[model samples]
Every structure is written in structure tokens, then in C-alpha cells.
Target: ERLALQALDRADRLGVAGYVLGIARELTGDFAGSMRCYEAALKLLPNHGAVAGDLGRLAFRMDMPEIAAKFFMHYLQARPGDLEGVNNLACALRDLNRCEDAIEVLRPAINEHPAQPLLWNTLGTIMCSLGDGVTAVTFFDETLRLAPEFGKAYHNRAYAKIDLGDVEGALTDCELAISVAESAEDLATMKFGRATILLALGRVAEGWKEYEGRFSADLLEAPRFTIEGERWSPGMDLASKSLMICAEQGLGDEVMFANMLPDVIEALGPQGKLSIAVERRLVPLFQRSFPQITVTPHRTVSYEGRVYRGAPEIEDWSAIDLWTPMGTLLETFRPTVASFPNRLNFLVADPARVEHWRRELENAPTGPKVGLLWKSLKLNGERARQFSPFMLWRPVFETPGVTFVNLQYGDCSEEIALAREEFGVDIWQPPGIDLKQDLDDVAALCCAMDLIVGFSNATTNLGGACGAPIWMLTGASSWTRLGAQTYPWYPQTRCFITSDYNDWDPTMQKVGVALKARFPMA
Candidate 1:
């Protein structure tokens, strides 16, 4: 530890004690310790732009995004011309979920440093995050112009083009990115992007091959499994080997693929043991849904645990040919709506809860029980496709004998009050139901309602699961495609798309008309 003290002494002499200590703490895997050191150093050298930037980065690492944003802004104020400061500040703002503010902060720096490839690339990422893929594509193109070998920029541009429905353009960008990618991570990203684009364009054969890149260590880092003696093929596999199918992506993906468990079992035959690793919360749902498979409750593979000799782990199955989740597999085998699963039996709400909601609805009126969700998810890339709060359900609220219910979460008290006061409509909202609560109640509420209307969010997912008749207002650049009225997972749901990138009026108008016709009151 003498060497460590000498390093600290050197850092103190350079007036960078905080940064050095923070770095040392981070290297030792003591994130909380690093944060404290950074905080202490900031107290001594408050106006040091570089130290402030490092502090902000440390806060971000700790997931204290709001604090990180504050420090990043302070760093930018102290050193306005520092490119690193500007970039870090922009990223912090983005993490704090101030996407528009992040864009505005980067605009001036981008203008000043037009030839800086990284700046252009960052600007592109911010624009994409803000749901402005059309504009993001331009920034990404500029990044490529400045640095043709920039693989990340190409990969990002492909994502933007995909959002804009320029499938061909996205494919070209992905190909270019794959060619220039040096690292396994970059190559996997490019490959996945290409696979998604190909699947969207209905090019299944190539898409499935590229989609296998998700299994790579650079992507998931999860162990692959293979049985010692077993023949595996597309149509026939009579192996008694245990196959562990782990959830690789988001919650929605897990839900989507859960419908295909029967198909997987069929492919492997009765002798094969099918084990699945999924989120802990979903364990109950999956267990209830599929009794045939052994459901494992593990979100991620543990790298530190001692290996069990008897039981088959994910690592042992690496040699067995793995397949992508149901959606990707369906696309590869039969890239059409006709092949969609018809036996999707989503769990219904508790009978008592459903009956209680039904009684409440019955006592109110003979009018239409309407569920309203105003806000869209800010975390997803398609936030730009969402209509303003005021624009949503305006026409529907104007309709006679329609009771509007608030299904929105978070800080929506103002919006709830405004809707009640301005429209003279009853907004049904229960007490003690905050964002922390699981969506089970919301699903039950949807079941009680005559119709559910909302922007694309968990509400839609909940409504779909309960088999409630739902009208979804979707963004133009949404991951869910256009002209697809029905989602395979939710047979009872219908989607309404925005005609333009940011316009919601037309979609809202259609919803109003549809609601009026479906449930008319005297």
C-alpha cells in the first residue's frame, strides 16, 4: 500500500486529489467510496471543470442521474468550450430524461465543431433518443462524412433509418458498419441491427442467421449449452438433453416468446427436458401458463457461483444449436400474419377484483366506461411519435355520455385535475395506486371497462393480456409497424397509427369516431 499512498501524494501535488482517489476507488470496485472521494475533491476545487465532469461521471455510474446532471451542467458553465464537458453534460441530461434539453445543449457545440466526428455521432444519438430519427439520420450521415470508418455511427444511423421505415437504407448502413467494426461488440450490434431490419422487411432466411449474433459473448455473455450425444435439427430432434432457454432482452420480448413454449417442446419431442430462465416476477405467470416445462427463476447467469456437477447449466448447452425467441423464429420460419399463434390464453384478473370494478362501473351509468392513458413512455426511442396530453382524448371527451378514467401513472395530478375541471367529465382514479404498484390492478380495471384507449405503453400491454377491447394510438416511428391493425399477442387489440411523424390529430379523430360508433348512449 506504500505505492498507493505515493500515488495519492502525487495527485495532491497536482491539485487532482479527488479525481485520483475516485479513480483508485473505482479500480478497487468500491463505487460508493469513489463517489465520496469525488464529492470531497469537488469541495476543495469547486470550479475545476475537469473534476466536476469526473464527479458527474461518477454520479452517473452510481445511477444518481439527477445529481450527475447538476454537476455536468456546472462543469459546462465553468468550461463552455470544453468538448468533453459538453458531451458529458449532454449525456447526463439525456440520462436524467431531459431529451429536448439534451438536444438543445448539444446543438451549439455541434455547430462550433462541425468536423468533429464524435460530436456529430453524439448529436445523432441524442436526436434518436428524442424520437427524431429523421433529424438523427442527418447527424449520423455527417458523422460518416467526417469519419467514414466510424462503425458506431453507421450502426446508429441504421437504427434511425429503421425508425423512419427506410429499411433499404438501414440495411446498407448495417452492412457498412459490419465491414468496419473492429470489436466483437460493434460487430454484434451491426449484425443485430441488420437482422431486425431484414425481419421488418420480411427477409426471414438472412434475418434469422444474423439474429444468432445475440448469443455471442460480446452481446449477452451468457453461457451456451449442448448435450454430449444428441442430434439436433430444425424439424427433428429426439435428444433427451435438457435445453435451457434464457430470456435475453426486455420484458415485452419475454412475454412475446412465452407463447411459443409449446412449439419448442414439440420441436424437441417428449423426451427432451425444457428449462427456462426468466425474471422472478414472471415466474408465477409462466408456471401457471406452461405446466410442461421446468421454469427456472433466474434473471441473469451468476458468474461467481461454484459449478454444480450433476445439473445441466447454460454453459453445457452452448454446443446444442440455439434459436432466437418466438417472434424472430416465427419470422424466420413463416414471415406472415397467417402463422401467428392462435392459442394465446392470457391470464384473467382475480374474479373478486373484476366483480368489484364491474359493480363500480354499473352504479355510475349506462354510458361507455372508457379507460384513458395520456402519457407515453419517455425511455423508449419512439417518444416523438406520441401526441401531446391535451391532444389525446379531446374529441373522445367531447362525445356525449362518455365517462373518462385516468389510467396514467407518475406526476399526473395536474393533468387529472385539468381534465376533470375543463371537460366536466368524471376521471376515475383510485387512491394509493402509484407507479410502485404492479400493473395487475390496471389489468383488472381494463377488464371492467367497455373499451380501453391509450397511447402505446404498459396500459396497452395490460389491456391486451386481459383480452380487453383496446384502441392504441401509436407513433409513426414506433417499433411496432404501421398498417398492422392487430398484434399477435393481443387478439382483441387494434392499433391506430399517426399519419405523420409527430401529428396525432388524425389518429385521435379516428378514435373518437370509432368509440362513438361502438358504444352509443341515449
Candidate 2:
């Protein structure tokens, strides 16, 4: 930084100085500072500059795919033949759910630069995004054949292999990818990939160790978390320690990982104090469930293009002895499938809220009240590939002696109407409670249901956490199963998995048959 500033002062090149500073700030996780520097550079060199490409990638890191696409397009116009710009623009389009358009953009680039392994690898990623694992694997093979040293291609092929139910093969590729990975990004990605494969294959101890790689990847931009001086390791003693467990990742993951919370508290012992920082929406439920510990809401703030997470609720950070990400507890408490306790659930829902929902369901048609969740709210091209289409749930709805309750969040009117009009299934929507926002009440509602069946979304995890009987509809490659047929975290939950997401008819039919067998027509 000193030398760059000295050079700028000597040459009077403000744009160059700003660009250099932006790169430095971004590398150090100062995203807002980086954006300010980049914007200054943009003002100085608005016509055409490398700053445009930097802004495009910065936009992507911040989760603004639309802005990312625009910046990448501008960069493409500035440098038409640049493979970096072409590949990034296509990736932005892919994230924007414009898969076909992304393909069109890639087609021309691939035709012109037939020898470019980067282009081939990007095409493979797009294919994986589209759920064509076989086609993706073929493209990855071509990429590796062109450049055997491309670690990204190896890591990408692992994704395709996992989708094709060759988890062991996927793990092998991930190991190979890590061996030849030269860049930090490629190495971190391969480690994370290996973690997913290991967890899916039921190698829990190794998976938890590899899962730490997430902090090295995109989460490097997040605020640093500490209790007193450092993070708690796998086998750290908690007898006289004060530990803060901050939830990481998505809401569903927080709920799922909370399966280890009870064990963590037990390990802390009477002399030890434990504090937890969780998603704000889960504060009430978590506090109620773990009354022995302090449950505070985690702070998540967004600036220019970065998300920052912190436990600002802690009044005395220095007083705390140790801290760890919530998932890290699994590394200590649960190293194998057998390590998981045979408990029904860890989280306890509001008993009054549970009874209230139960009485409300009693007023419905006299049969078993079954909660049905068919999709996640964030169903984009990439995420939608993981869930079954609502239309395929026709068979499950067709089963008699079950009053289907609407547990599917988001704007799912189309699905509810389709079930009623086409499948003759009238899904009763519980009044007054916001399925997405009222998470505490949602947990109670889940507890009230005779059975809750859905893909592994936040609601399903909540249901499973509270010991509600959950039949999760997932693929054979679901890593959350931890190489077990059932969710060891929630012993009450049953997994109904299919090998193919392309055709969910057979799986839906199986669920329907199971539904009938469980609740035959009265």
C-alpha cells in the first residue's frame, strides 16, 4: 500500500491509486471501503478501465446478480474477446435465473475459443445448474482433457458425480482437485466440496473438519467472531469456559445444527456458562428451548455489497472464554452416526401455541391433519433443481383420510389452487399466522400437525427439531442425512429419498402410498 501510494503521488494517477486500494480493501474483507475506492476509480476513468471488471465481481460477491450482470455486460463491451469477462457475465446471468440466455452467451464464446478450458468449465457449471449432471460431467471431462491442471474442473466434476449418486467417485475427484489446486479460491472450494461429499457419505468426523473450509471461502468477508481470545477447537475443554456459539449459514442449517446444542450445554457443565447467538426470528423458540443459557439474536447487516454478521448483543465480549460457530459443535459432540443421541428432538415449541393450533385443526374435516410443504420460497433455477415440483405432489394429495394443511410458505397460491381445482385436494391454510415471518408460531403449528411432510426447508427442520413427525422428501445424495437412512439429529424424522430429481413421480407415488398406509380412509 505504501509503495502504491508513493507511485500514485509521483505519477499523479488518482485512478490507479483508487483501483489498487480497492483491490487491497476487498482482499482484507473491507467491502464497503473497497466499493468506495472502486467508485472513485470509476469516476476518474468512466469510459473504459479494469475497474469495471472489478465492480462486476464485487457485485456478485454482494449478492446483487442484476447489478453484476449489468457491470459484466459493460466490461464485455469494453473488452469483447476477454474470456474472463465472458465467463463472469455468463455466471451472472446463470445466477439471475437466465440459464438459457447464459447458454446463448457461452455458445458463441465456446465456438470462437474452442481451446479455452475456462469456457468449457463454465459451461459445465451451467449444465450442473440446469440439473443435467450427466451432460455436466461430459463437459467437465472435456475441460480436464484440455487442461489437466485445472483444479476448478475437477471440483466441478465432483458436483456432477454427487448428483449422479456416485458420492465416492465425487470424493475422489475432490481429493484430486485439492492436490493440484494452485489458487486459494480453488483450494478452498475443493475442501468445501470434499466436506459435502464426506458428510453425504456418512464420514461425519472428517466432514466436520473439512466443513471449516467455508470460512476460507465466501465467508471471509463476514465479520470476525470471537468469545474472548480465539475460536474453540474440536476437543476444547468447556469445564470452566464461557463459550459463545454463533449460528452460521441459513435458517434451516441453524435449526438442523442446533441438534448438537443440548450436548454442548451438557459438556459446558454447571460451572461453565454458554451463550448462543441465533437468527432473530428464532430467538423466542431457542430461548424457550434452552432456558439454561442466554439466547441472543445475531446481528446481520448489509452494506454496499457485503453481509456482516456479529454478536453485538454480547455486553462483555472480553469476559467470554471461548467461542465457536454452531456447526463446530458437531465436530466435538457428534463424530459419527452413532454419536448422535436417540432423542426425539432438541427444541421445545410453545405448549399453548401447540394446543391452540391443535384445536383449530379439530374444526377441519374429521381426519388426520397433515402438513404439506412442497417448495422453498427462494426457488430460483439453482435452488428449484433441489426440490420437487408442486404438480408432482398430485399423488400425495390424492390420498384419502388426510386433511392437507398449507405449510408451504411464500406466494404459493398457484399450488394451493392447483391442488384444489385439479387434484381435488383442499389444503387448509391456518389463519392469522405468517408462515414465513411467525417462525415461533410456525414451530408450534408444526408440532400440532399429525404428520409434517416436505423437502428439507426451514419449516421442515423446525418441525423435526420440535419432534413433530417429519417425512422429508429429498434426493439420495442429501448430505444432511449424514450417511444415515434417517435424520440422526431428529430421530422422529423419516427420510424418503429418490435417486432422480428429473422424475419425482415414483417418489411422490411412494409418499402417497405411505400416506394411505399410515392414515387409511375412515
- Highest TM-score among the candidates is held by which one? 2
RMSD in angstroms, all models? 5.9, 2.7
TM-score of 1: 0.75
Model 1 residue runs over 4 Å out of place are 1-67, 107-111, 114-121, 124-126, 181-187, 204-209, 212-245, 265-284, 291-337, 344-352, 376-390, 430-441, 480-485
Worst 10 residues of 2 by lDDT: 219-228
Please write out the lDDT profile of model 2 over residues 304-411, one tens digit for every residue: 445567888788888788888888788888899999888888999999999999999888887899998888877665676778777888889888778989997898
Pairing residues by index, what is the TM-score of model 2?
0.92
Candidate 1, which ten residues in sequence have the lowest lDDT sum?
302-311
User: Best lDDT goes to which candidate?
Assistant: 2
Candidate 2, after superposition: displacement of residue 360 in Å? 1.7
Error (Å) of candidate 1 at residue 398 is: 2.8
lDDT of 1 by residue, 1-522 (tens): 235457667765444656677778766656677777777777878888777887788776555678888888888789876888788777777766677787788888878887889888877877776657778888898998999999999988987776666767888988999999988757876787777677666565556566666556555332343223343334444356556665545455666555556666776676777777665655665665567876655534332211111124444555444433334444333445455566534545556666778877776655777887777545433344355446465778877887776777666778777777887766776544453245556566778887888775656665666577778776543444322446655666777766444345777888888877777662
